[model samples]
Target: MPAFAQDSDSETSNNTMKNTEYVTFYPSYGYQDEGLWRIPLRVWVHKHGGWGGKQLSKVAKRVVRNKAGLEELHQDQIEMFRFRFRDFVADSQSFEAIFLRFDQDPDEEVFRLQSADGDKRTNFNGLLFGELTLTFERAEELLTAQQSKNGWLRFTATGKDHQGEGAVRLIKPQGDSVISDIDDTVKITEITEGEAVVMMNTFFKPFQAVPQMKALYQTFDENVALHYVSGGPWQMYRPLADFLFKTAGFPPGSMHMKNVRLHLLEGETYGDFYRLIKLGSVASEQQKIRQISEIFSHFPQRGFTLIGDSGEHDPEVFAHIRNQFPEQVNAIIIRDVVNDATKNPERLQGMKVIQADSAFIDADG
Candidate 1:
């Protein structure tokens, strides 16, 4: 959609190059409409270093050979092209610049500069990386290419020190709706409480839902936008984003959470303060409820569903949303936590409250 420069010419010239080449790969068609195909391409840049320094000598591309290959691409593939960098010496300063051009179109060119570690361990930048450009073509060509010889598409790119080539495919979008929690939703393992203090520091994987959630996530990802609201601090946005994209099966979308600095307090300790100030005061949960209300208020035509666990205030918060925004909320599903569904009779009355094991099935129904 937009143009990106991979590296600066100065940076490229500074590095010593034992070899420099460009490789192109086949293109992957992601989405097709009105004869236009959204193609995905993966390009890799490799470099070798000299006494002066390490430098990129070649760039390579990976193409999808089958539909199953599409799974290798991450969510960012929907909008951006990404690659992983591997094999570098420890503390060595070596980088590679990649320039991508599609079909001799100057305006479609994209660029990126990737650095490598000196160790052989192969470190990746972000789990996702890449650039996207629009291409105009008939969908028939894409479908035919898949079935015909040489019909499959490919990607070609030139690099300062290297080149790459590969195949491409048309990918279909996942249309699913996601209902998620915010606090332990994507960050620390547990909710923000006294126990969470130890849990957070225990080096446990972030609080992302287990892989079992993927089935439920896929159910709505193909059709509905993910709605993530949390009682946790909003500062965890970046980690949350990574968690959703990498661990949990949430597509890119907006996240809602409390302003901890403005709402949550210190001196009382995280746990005591949260329970005393957060649940004790309706302001925190109210903030989330109001956000949901605003969402339904603006998009009344779209179906809205509520997903939360009984661990914290999700039950009450979701119930409030259901009561206030009945027409917009298709269903409310709460994952049981404390086994005290009756604690909040007002929140449970007439609403669907299922155990975690059953919530997904009931939500699908």
Candidate 2:
């Protein structure tokens, strides 16, 4: 939720700017507990392969875009990109420490710095990693949920070679929050079509949101916090957020996306295609389990409705979450993208699993 809490749903901004230089921050969202406000902000710095890779890429692009030529060009470009991107983790340095400042009410005021406090140093050991935390002991603005469940904090991150400024949101618990998946459930990725579909969706095509998702979410009153939790890589977090707010009229909340591992690739361009084969793997299954369960753990008392598609193991993963947090998980909603496993039912255990063709259909059940 880029704009914070909107209407009645949770508005946590999963914002990231795509740039060749400096660090990129994932869509940062936080919930206030009691008087404490915490934001798990993640940032990554890009030193780039710098001018060498840039010039080389330019030269390579001029050589023609054939498969053989493109592959070689990508290899060179990746090597160069990785080279400068590794200086932060060299043997000489244990970790690079970066300073940060937080302003509760960012304005030209008298007690500006006093209103907010994030004057601390965060140690970064990885080029692309979740670093630092903004902890506020007395978050009065955020604590006043009676007035409004949302508040904003302007923050600045500074290092020798990097500097960035952005706003972190605070959403105090209202009531039930919906944790939804992006791929097939909320958007049409054509998972049933496999590799060709993945390639088309990931690269050459415009992302399409599922029908009636915006109007469907609005049916629930303004207080239902809506969080989007997806296995999509952090690399595309911004694009996903853009689609949520701009393309679809759904209000934002906490958006949690998985980090991209360098090893999770088949090819620079065709890596996404491998997801078809990896769909039901034990590894991917466990990942989905951890991703969604951890969220349930964090907000133990908040009622949640788990939403995902049958394309992957969202059903099983959500099933595990229902078992793990029996009291917290309200219901498991799985969109039938593939087989109607719900007829006989898969491994749903004793939880209430609802299978539907669309999220808008039979959503009340």
Candidate 3:
């Protein structure tokens, strides 16, 4: 995996340290491979100037007005926007490595994260906007030092003078599992309602869980592992994570989301930032397929229940994955966001489709 750094890494490290910064350890999963434990550890490092000033809000409103729609944003919407957008406009940090402490005391042995391809330090694209994500391959004996009875472990990480904590869920080589989509399946995004509506729901409105969706997930016993794979960008991780595991009462699980980056753009204007959001947030079918396939390859003896929404390409993507791993995929459930799945059979030909207002869904076939 490539390294992640901010666009302004050329600036002095002292200057970067003076600025208010934050770090996020995205939830990841661990697996045993060839007598070793490996974690696809993902971390994001950046600086936030805080939301006390409206300068950031003004810029964000301009971007939303130009990109989301011509409608004027309410005061509440602007406040909501600032909460998530605070991390988006911040500068990413360039660090040689991050320190990791496993499920031991603070004085225990700490490990450093590094790439499998022999890059001693992490690399980051100096983009003007968007979140910076660092994914490292760590195959170490530290994890195996302590066995977990519940098949999960917790770890605290510190890097670039920022402190954050994350957890990893380990699945057995053979068991039943559920791979789910985030946007319209469990959370309401109104994706089929067009770009403006999608933006409003994503940035402006309060996040609401699909009726009884949390209860549906609760039905899965501790034996069945959970994975949330979404087309959303990693920048949305904080809000989404809280909404899922905290506010909405859904089970905690490993997350896999699209990387956030706008390449070489300066991102100084509203238009540029709008393009960053529009261009970078779109879902890549191949990306979803490849991510799910990696999970399947990791646990060939496991059975999976694929759950997604009909708003986008979940049906097609799930169908493709089912075809590729016929023995592993036991069922496919598609939440009908458009409310026309039965009318258009071809769209979800062989998959199971439920109504938009479905109060419950069965993952067990």
Top model by lDDT, which number? 3
Worst 10 residues of 2 by lDDT: 5-14
Compared with the true structure, what per-residue lDDT tens digits does model 3 show for residues 24-84?
A: 5677666666754566766666655534324655665576655567568778877788775
Computed on alpha carbons, the lDDT of every model, listed in order, comes to: 0.42, 0.52, 0.66
Q: Which pairs of residues clash in candidate 3, taking residues 3 or more apart in a chain or in different chains?
A: 3-123, 4-123, 4-124, 5-124
In TM-score terms, which candidate is top?
3
Query: What is the number of residue pairs that collide in model 1?
Result: 67
lDDT for model 1:
0.42
* Cα RMSD of predicted structure 1: 14.9
- Model 1 reaches what TM-score against the true structure? 0.46
Write the number of the candidate with greater lDDT, choosing between 1 and 3.
3
| Model 2 superposed RMSD (Cα) | 8.6
Stretches of candidate 1 above 4 Å error? 1-179, 184-188, 196-208, 262-281, 342-346, 357-365
Candidate 3 segments exceeding 4 Å error: 1-21, 50-57, 66-74, 125-149, 263-283, 362-365
Backbone N/Cα/C clashes per model:
67, 8, 4
Worst 10 residues of 1 by lDDT: 57-66
Which lDDT tens digits does candidate 1 get at residues 191-214? Answer: 434443422221122344533344
Global lDDT of model 2? 0.52
Question: What's the lDDT for candidate 3?
Answer: 0.66
